[model samples]
Every structure is written in structure tokens, then in C-alpha cells.
Target: MKAIIAKSNIGGVITTPPSKSYTIRALLAAALASGQSRIFNPLVADDTEAAAEVLTQLGAGIKRQTDCWEVTGGNLAPPSSPHQKLNCRQSAATLRFLAPICAALQGTSCITFAPGLARRPMTPLFDIFQQLGVRSELTENSLNIHGTGGQFKSNEVSLPGNISSQFISGILMATPLASEGLTIHLTTPAESKNYLRMTIDCLQRFGINVEYDDNLEEFRVEHQAYQPTDYIVEGDWSSASYFLGMGALSGPVTVTGLNADSFQADRFMLNCLRRMGAEVIINGDSVTVNSSPLRKTDTGLNEAIDLLPSVACLAGVSAGESVITGLDRARLKESDRVTAVADNLKQMGIKVIEESDRLTITGGTPRGAVIDSFDDHRIAMAFAMLAAICGDTVIEGAECVNKTYPDFWEDFQKVGGKVSINE
Candidate 1:
């Protein structure tokens, strides 16, 4: 879909979508528990739906309610039909978590992927599964795992952490069911450490305990049961970052339903906006970023890599040249966001230099130009915010926001941003 943006200045109060990370984590935890688990404020977006659907296919019962989800889980049965295929649509988390989970279920299962996900990285997790005695028939498009139910050859495994924390999260979720439990040692320093912490936090909410060191290099889990309980997903800092950026570029935009104390990594977005001289007001559970004289500074996105696209938009309109780093891992996301962000910004008459691990965007008012989202949700939303500040612009693949924020277009309009859909 295409989004036509004409009005530059935008402001108003709007609540951001629920956190996709927390929502999926809650769903996976509910699926691992033995009884009914209620999940509140869950984000019912495409990525999360993939997790729910796949978990349901693996024998969990998921009942959707208007306000919450009731899921009965912990009894994973083989599919009634032959060669049950779990289509993990573009959610990397769903694919990673469920693949190891199916292996632990002690049955033969095939996990398939969408076209974009088909090319995602699977190594190390694949090898880790094999080290645990999981036989697999892996191809470019699908993975068929065969393992002895409730059995793992060893109680300890090691894998590099620089690639993704999801691999460790996947194995950790399944270890509770391991006959002897399991210990995981990180072969290298962990990247996206916050995500690992989120996984552990989610596990604790389900009454599962995990032992880990301060550096997060090692974790130990013993045989335990996951206790089902009500879980509430918090608002997403990642999604709110864009609106906050919009407010920083425009003025006085208040985004509600956020926990200021949450450990979500994208909370760094608030700090970054302030560093750029944006006036920020924080109420109990809401944050407002008001427009002010902006200044460019060195921005490190190591901990908040997902904030790259939105932050880069800020860099484009700030006073001086901004050097943004720690985005090398972002290449493996929904799209090649590094190139995509730089390319999209260039279309708007902004000077941007893209590199393997960094981006340098020269600050100036960008002129309106048609931009492409490359079918990435974050890319679409980030550029859409940029379009609001740059004046009349067209964003192709704007519907990609449905991946995480289904009502983004409507919300954009509600916030006083002009948007027209070109059908």
C-alpha cells in the first residue's frame, strides 16, 4: 500500500501499540504452561499471530477474547495429520522458539518459513539442536526435526552469542522439559542482551527459575514446571519511539500506555531524543517529546538497534551531521534496514552515508519525494514519520506496518498527520 503525506507538522496524544516482544514472550510462556494462562494487552499483529497459530498447531489451545487470550498448554501432541507443517510467517522469534520446542516435544515436525524468512540465519541453533541429539532434515525453505521426546544427550551446550539472543532463548524455553535440565554457556559476548533478559523475566513470571551470572555469559536451568498465570504485556517502546520522534520533529506529541521503568531496550529512544535537545515531559505512564532546537551528536545504537530507522529520521532533520553506529546486526532484520534506511532517506533529498556498522546522516530539511519501505514494518513507519516532517510525500509498501502496528495509518491520522491511501 502507499501512504500519501501532505501536512508536515503533526501533534496529538495517541497510545502506542502493545509490545510485540513481550506479547510473543507471553504467548510462548502460556503455551509452555500446563493450564489456562491469560494474556492481557497482547498485540494481535501479524508477527505475534504467527507465534500463536504455530503454538496452537503444536497442541496448545488458544482462545481469543475481546480483551485477553486464554491459552491452555503444556501438552504437545503430534499433529493428527501426516507431516504437520508450522508456517512461521516472517516472525524470526516464532521460528526460533518453536523449532527447539518442537524438538523437545519428541516428535517429527516440519517448520516452514515465509519467503523472507526462508533466507534468515539458522545456523548455530541448527548445530545446537544436533548437539542435543536432534536429527534434522534442513533445507533452504523448511526444517524437519526429529528427536527423542523429553530427552537430551547432554545437560550443557555452548554457542556464540554475537549472532542472536533468540537462539539462546529458544533452547532455554525447551530446557525446562529436558530430562536432566540444561546449562548454556555463551561462547562469546552476547549481543541484544536485553532480549535475553526479557526472556528470563518472562520465564520467571510463569514460575520458572533460571540461574545466570552478571555478564549473562552462563545460565543454568533445572527440571521445573511452568506455572500458568495471568500475564499482561506492556506498551512497546519500539513503536512509541517513532511517534516520539514525530513529536520531537513536530511538537508536544504525548504517547501513553508506556512503563517508564520497563527494561525494554528501546527505552533508550527517550534518552537519545533528549540528547538531541528535544523537550521531553514524562508523566506516570506516558511520555511527551516536544519540538525544540535540535543538535546532532554521536549516537550509538548498540543496545537499541531497532531504533535505528526512527533515530536516523531524527538525524536527517537535526542541526549538524550525526554519526550513528552499532547497526551491523540490523542487516538481518525484516529487511536490510541499514541500506533501506539510507536509500529511503536519500529519496527525500537527505545526504546519508551507509556503512557496514554505521550511518552518517547530514541534518537538513528534506524535500518531499516518493520513498519505498522494502516491505519492512519499521522501515515503513520510520519513513512515514520522516514524510510528516518533510511535507507531501508518498510511501510505498506503507501497509507493511501491519506486521507490528496494524492501525498505524489510522493512528497517524488521529495524531493530526494527513494521510491518504492510494488504492
Candidate 2:
């Protein structure tokens, strides 16, 4: 899919979409509980659907409604046969979270994924599984795992923290089912600790508790059962980033339904925009960003890695060169986002200096050019915002936004962005 964008001034009020991370976490927690749990305002995107499908395959009863999903959990049955597969599609969270949970259940289950997810790093989780005496066989795109019948041999394990926060979250979610409490030690300083905070927040709502130190290198989880509870997913700051950037570049835009106190890493977008000299207003659950001449700002993405692409786009048109550091982990996402952002900016006639851990972008009058999205959702959306400013910009793989925001283009139009789609 391709989306051709024309330059335009955008101003409107948009209700933020539900958080994908919170939706999946709530679904998994609900699926682990012993009774029925109702999740309200859950995200209906590709990733969340993948998590729900994987849980259904694991014997959880899920009833989909207009605005709520009722999940009956606590009686997980292993795959009926070795041929019965649990497909997680392209959602990395689904695979990571379910792999550990399946390992603690009885019977054999084969977890399979698309090629994109297959290329992600899973060795850390597999190595930890070995310490827990969970037998597993791996293929290029599938994992054939044998459960310990609900008990891990080891209660303590260690792994690197810089790779992916999902690994830590996966372990924390599954630990409650283990016979003994588990202690997780991180060999390196942890990045993206906000995600772990989100996971802990969701777990606590379902009657589970997690403890960690200030530095977030170690975690302690006691054996407990998940209690069924009603969960309401908050609005996503991640998806709202593009529109926020649009407001900064174009006109006043207000986005509602956001939580002022959210553990989501992307919630830092407001701070980032403020640092860049964009006018940001907060009124209750709504945030409004007004068009302003932005100045150069040096920012670190270690805690909010997902904002790399959008931040880079904003930097391209700022007043001076902007430095974005702590980007080493960004390369390991759905695409090499650092390279993608650099390439796209260069195509638009912007000056960019790319490095392994940082990017230096010089503000300039960007010209419209064809952008390759690399089939990454963030890349597509970020560039789309840039396109509204650049005009005559064509974004390839524009449909990729379905991974997180299915109605992104529609919302773009709602905000007065002029675009034509080609399928």
C-alpha cells in the first residue's frame, strides 16, 4: 500500500486510541485468572488480536463485544497434539509472553510466528528456559516446547537487560504459576524500564504483585494466583505521537482520552515536544499542541525507544541540529529504524548524521520525496506526519500502520491531512 500526502495545515480534536501494550497485558493477565474478567476499551489492532488468538488456542474462553471482551481463564490446556500450533502472527509480545506461560503448563505446544518476528532475538528467553528445566526445540520460525507441568526447576535466572523489555515482562507474568518464587537479575543496566512498570501495573490490577529495586536491575515475584478483575485500557501515547508532531509542525491539535499519569514510555512525547519549544497544554484528559517554531533539542531515547522515528522527523525541520542518543536498541525493532529514519530524511533533502547509538539531524526546509516505510508501523506513521508538512510525499507500505493503528490514515484525514491511498 502507498499513501501520497499533500502539504496542509491540520487542526482538530482526536480521541487517542487504546494502548496496545496495556490491552495485551490485560488480556494475558485475564487469561491467567481463575474466573471471568472484563476488559473495557481494549485495542482492536493486529498485535492485540494476535495475543487474543494465541490465548484462545491455549484453551481460554474469550467473548468479543462492541466495547468489552469477557475472558474466562485459569484452565489452560496444552496443545491437543504436537501438530496443534499456537500462531502469534507478527506480534513479538504474544510470542514472548506466551512462550514462558506455555512452558509452565502440561503437554506440548508449538508456538509459531511470521518471518518478521522469527528474526527477533529469543535466545535470552531460551537460555533462561534451560535453567528452569523447560525442554524446548527451536526451528527457524517455530518453538516446540515441553512444559514442566506447571513447575520450574530453578527460581533464579539472569539475562541482559538492553535487548528487549518483553523478555523481563514475559518472565514476570509466568513466575506466578511457578512452584516457587523467582528472582531475575540483569547483567547490564536496564533500558525501557517504563514497560516493566506498565507490566507490573497490569499484573497488580489482576491481583499479582512484583517488586524491583530503584535501578530496575533485579525483580522479585512471589507465587500467587491471578484474580479476575475488570480492566480498562488507557489511551495510547505512542499512536498519538504522529498527530502531536503534526500539531507542532502545522496548527493547534487536541487529543483526548490520554492518562496524565501513565507508565507508558511514549508518554514522554509531551516532555520531548516541550523541550523542542512546542506549546503544549494539558486540560484534564486532553492535551493540545500548537504550531510553533521549534528549536534544536538534544534528547535520549533510552527510556522511550519507540519515539525515535517521530523525534527524528521533528528534528529534521527544527531550527538547528538535534541530537538523539541511546538508539542502539532501536535497530532491533520491526526494522532497522535508525537507518530507515536517516534514509528517509536524506531523501527529503535533510542533513542527517547516523551512528550506532545516535543520530544528528540538521533542521532544514524538507522537500517531498518517496519514503520507504520498511514495513514498520512507526516508520510509516512518523513519515506520514512529515509528509503533511513536506507535501507530495509518498509512503510505501502505508498499510503497515495496521500493526498498531488501523485507522491512522483515517485519523490523518480527520485532522485535515490531504492524502490519497493506493492499494
Candidate 3:
């Protein structure tokens, strides 16, 4: 899939898509509830679909509706026939969240991962699972676990802060079913604390109380039932950041349907945009950005790491040099995003310096160059936004957006972006 994006300015209003992070959290949280639950404005993307399918196979009743999804879930019933295989479809969240839940169920289960996802690290969370008496065997691209089909062995689980927050969330969601409670101690000061905040939000929304200190060094949760409730998914700040980046260089772009108080970590992009001199307007649930004197950035990405590609793209067109830090976690994503962003920027004749944990981009007028997305959705979207100012831009693997936003191209076009597909 190739996308040819020509230089143009986008204007008018486009509503941001619902958050994939929140939708998946809602699905997983709902699956543990004892009764019917309604989730409104859920994101129906590849990743969220993977979560839904896995939950369905776990014997949860999931029904799609016009405006929401009705989920009836309680105890998971092992697929009537034994030895059922589930494909996680390259979603890290799906794999991480499901692994621990399957262990809590104490049932025979096997999960297969897409080829590209096989190499993602898992031992950190698995170590804790093993501590809870969940036995697992790892082979290439798949995980086979024998779950006790009930509460885990109550114990203190310590995890490093650098890994994906999904690790913390996955365990937090599953430990409540254990015979006793569990305490999560952060061995290092927790990084990406906002993602954990989202996890805590989900847990509390489902009627599970979480105890944590101000520093977020420790968390304690006991065996508790997840109560079903009506929930609404919020607009994704990560996805919306792309358009806001475009708005900084282009004109009159406004994204609606976002929550100002969202726990979604990417919401911090608004502050960064302000720092870079983009005119941002927050009216009700929508945010509008207009042309401004965009400048270079110096910010930490510990929490908003997913915004790296977009923010880096914004930096590519700014007037001076920009430095972004805290990218060590980026290497573990679907693709080595840090390297991918740096390489693609270099391809476009932009001056960039790539390091293991930081990126320094000297913003100037960039020329369009053929770029590969490295099968990363954010990379494709990031460069797409950058294309508006470049001489010409062609993005391969453009369809990767389906992982989070299936209609990304259409939405881009809707906002007056001059984009065409070359298939």
C-alpha cells in the first residue's frame, strides 16, 4: 500500500477517532464483569477487534450494536472443545492482557502471535504469572499456558518501571480473581505513570479499588469482583496528535470528540504544541489548532512516547533544532520507532541525529522522499502529516493504520489533505 501525499493545507473540522487504548481497556474490563455492560463509542480497529475476539473465545458474550457494544461476561468457560488456538494478531495489549487472564482461569489455552510480534519481550510479566502458579511454555510465536481457572496465588509481585504499562495493567486486571489480593511494588520509580493512571481509571470504573502512593512506587489490590457498568470510550489523543501536528504547519484544523481531562497520556501533546507556539483552542470537547510560528521542542517522552513520530514530524518542519528524549522504550514497539523515524526523516533530506535514547532533528524545509512505514501505524501517520509541507511524499505500508485507525486515509482526505492511494 502506497500513499502519495502532495503539499497542501488542511482546514475545517474532523472528529478524532475513539481511543484504541480506552476501547481495549473497556473490553478487557467488561469481560471480567458479572453482568451485562455497555461500552459506548468504542474504537473498532484491528487491535480492539483482537481483544474482542479473544474475549469471545474465552466464553464472553459480545454483541455489537449501533452506538455501543453489549458485553455479558463473568467466569470464562474453556472453549467447549479442548485445545483451541487464538491468534492475537500482532497487538501487544491483547497478548499482555490475555496472558494473565488465561492464567487466572486455570484452563488449557494456547495463543499465537503474528510473526512481527513474536519478538516482543514477555518475561517480566510472565515471571509474575509463574509466581502465581500459572504454568506456561513458550515456543516460536505462541504461548501455551495451563491456568488454574480461578484466583491466582496471592503474593507480592515486583516489576521494573521501564516495560510497557500494559504489563502492570494486565496483572492488575487479573489479580482480583485470585484467592487473596496482590501487591505490585515498583522496583524502579514508575515510568509512563499516565498509562498506569489509565489502568487505574479502568479498574476503578469496573468497581475495583486500587491503592497507590503519590510517587506511584507501590500499588495494592485485593481479590475483588469486577462489577459491570456503562462506559464511554474517549477520543484518542495519540491519533488526534497527528492532525494537530498538521494544524501547526497547515491551517484551521480542529479535532472534536476528545476529553480534556482524559487519562490518555498523549493529551500532553497539547502542552507541547503550545510550547512550540501553535495556536490551540479548547472549546467544549473539541480542540482546534491554527497556523502559528511553530518552533523546535525539548521535551521528555516518558509518558507520551507514542507521540514521538508526530512530534518528531512537527520538529522536522520547525525553524531550529529540536531534541526529544526518553525514547529507549520506543525500540520495543511494533517497530524500532526511534530508528524508523530517524531513518525516514533522513530519507526525506532532513538533518537528524539518532541515538539509543534521544533524537535531535534540525527543522528545515524537507523534500518529499519515498518512505517506508516499517509496518508501524504511527510512522505512517506521522509522515503523512509531515507531507503537507514537503515537496512530495510517498508512504509505503500505508495501510498499517488499520491497526488503530482504519479510516485514517479517508479522514485525512476529509480534512482537505491531498492524498491518493497507489495500489
Candidate 4:
């Protein structure tokens, strides 16, 4: 579906969506724990749903209640009857995180996905799985995984930091369950360290112990079992960043249901926006953002790359020029985010310069133009936020926001954003 945005002003209170990061982690832990676990405020986005479906296929009993989900766990088991296919669609987390778990399961399983996922590089993950005695073959759009069920030897494995960190997190999540504990060594500086921290924190919450020495660039997991517990997923800070951008660019918007101390890296948007002259108030689990004259500054936000799309939107509306650096890893995300931002902003008549890793935006009044989302959720939402400043913008492939925020357009509409879908 396509969407058009008319010029509008935004100022209202909106509750953020549940955190996909927390929801997926809780689902994985619940599926691994021995007893039933309750997850509250679970996300119902495509990615989270993919994780739920994958966990269900892995022998976890899932029951969705009115507002919560209960998952009963046991040994990772493939479908009772043999099945040749497990489709993950376009969820990277489900495909990457579930692969090793499926490999460690009792039977053989084959994982397949949509075309976009099929074309994604999986050689790095395949090499790691090979070290664990798991054999996988990549066909047209499927990965045929044959597990030896042999013991996973604990060894030091070095990973390149340029690619998706989910691969490392996937191996880390499965390591504690391995017969021998596993040790992971980082060959280069890990991009998205905050996401890795979220994984480690979730593992500890499930009663698995992981010891890490960042200075030594090593992580060790002990052979242990997970203890199921009630997990509450916080509201998504990444999703909240869009609204925060709107508030910064437009004015006096309040976003609730987000924790001020979220482990999610996108929470750093508070600081970035503050630096750009947005009035930000953080009170425990709530944040209120008010508009102020934004001035461009030189800031490095490598630790908060997930918020780059929205941050780019913020920078686009700010006064003067802003230089956002330390984003060499942004190209490998769901979309090549750097180019996506540059291309979309350029169409809006914003002066955007894209480098190999950094993006420089010369902020000025944006003129309305047609924008392409590149089928990326963040790109869609980021451009939507621009509607407050840029009048009469049309977003092609606007439905891509359903990947993370199914109700994004509706929520934006609630906050005085005039949007109409072109069916």
C-alpha cells in the first residue's frame, strides 16, 4: 500500500508500542525455560510474530490470552512429525536466532524464508554452525539444516563486527545449553554492543550465567538450564524515536510507556535530541519531548545506530548542518539505512551527503516530494515523521511499517498527523 501525508502539525500524548527486542528475548527465554512463562505487553509485529511461530515449532506450547502470552517450554524439539520446511519470512531475528536452536534440537529441520531473506548472506553463520558439527545447505530460498546432535565443542570463536551481531547473539544464546560451555572472542569492535547487552541481560534473567570481559574481548557461558519467570516487555524506544523526532520537529509531544533507563540502544535518542536543542524530560518510565530551536552539532552516535533513521529525520528538520558519524555498520541493517536516508531526504529537497559510513545533513526547510521506503520499516516511519515539516509527501510501500509498528500510521494520525492510504 502507498500513503500520502498532507501538511499538518503534531502535538498530543501517545503511548509507545511494546519493545520488539524485549518481546523476542522473552519469547526465546520462555521457550527455553522448563516451566511456563508469562510475557506481558508482548509485541504483535511481524518480527515478534515470527519469533512466536518459530518458538511454537520448536516444541514450546504457546497460548495467547487477552493481553498476555504464556509459553511452556521443554527440550528443543523439532515438529513431532518430519517437515521439510520452516518459513521465517523476512524476520532476521527469527531466522538467525532460531537456526542454532533448531540445529541443537533432536531432529533434522530445514529453514526457508522469503526472497529478501534468501538473498541475505549467511556464510558467516554457516561457518560457525559448521564448527558445532551442524551441516547446512543453501538452496534457492531455503537452508537445509542437518544436525549431528553431537556435542558442541566449547572453543574460542572470533567474529567480524561488521555484519549482523544477531549471529553472535544467536550462538551465545545457545551456548549455555550446550554440553560444554562456549567461549566467544571478538575479532573487532562489536557494533551494537547495547543489543548484545540486552541478550546477555535476558540470558541472566532466565537463570543462565554469562561472564564477559569487554576489555579482553571474551564471553563465556556455563552449561546451565534456564528458569522460567514472568517477563514484562518495555515499550519500544526505537519506535518511540519517531514520535520523539516529531515532537522535536513539531512540538510539545508526550510519549508514555517507555522506560527512561531502557537497555535498548535507541533510548540514546533522548541525549541526541537534547543535544540538538529539544527539551526532553525523563521521569522513570515516561518521557516528554517539547520542541525547541534545533541547532546542528557534531556528535558521534555509533552506540545508537538503530535510531539512525529517526535521527536522520530529526537532523533533516534541525537548523544548520549536522554531522552524524560512526555509522559504518548501518549498511547491513534491514536496509542499507545510510543510502535509504540519503535518497529519501534528497527527494524531499533536503541537502544530504552520504559517505561510506557517515551522513551529513544540511538542515533547511524541506520541500514536499515523493519518497520511497525501500520496503524498510524505519525508512517508512522516518519519512512519515517528515510530513510534519514537509508538506504533501507520498511514501511508496508505506505498509512496510507493519514489520515493526503495525499501528504506526494510526498512532501518528492520533497525534494530529493527517495521513491517507492509497489502496
**How does candidate 3 fare on TM-score?**
0.98
> Best to worst by lDDT, what's the order?
2, 1, 3, 4
- Using lDDT as the yardstick, the better of models 1 and 2 is 2
lDDT of 1 by residue, 94-145 (tens): 9898888888886788888888987678887778886798888888788888
Each model's lDDT comes to 0.88, 0.92, 0.88, 0.83
Cα distance off (Å), candidate 2, residue 58: 0.4
> What's the lDDT for candidate 2?
0.92
User: Per-residue alpha-carbon lDDT of model 4 for 107-148, expressed as tens digits?
Assistant: 678787878876567887887876777777888888877664
For candidate 1, the lDDT comes to 0.88
Candidate 1: clashing pairs of residues: 106-149
Cα lDDT of model 3 by residue, 361-398, tens digit:
99987888998999999999999887877748899999
Q: Is candidate 3 or candidate 4 better by lDDT?
A: 3
Model 3, residue 81: displacement in angstroms? 3.3
Give the winner by TM-score: 2 or 3.
2
RMSD values for the candidates in order, in angstroms, are 1.1, 1.0, 1.2, 1.6
Residue 190 accuracy (lDDT) in model 2: 86
Question: Candidate 3: what lDDT?
Answer: 0.88
Candidate 4: global Cα-lDDT? 0.83
lDDT winner between 2 and 3, please give it.
2
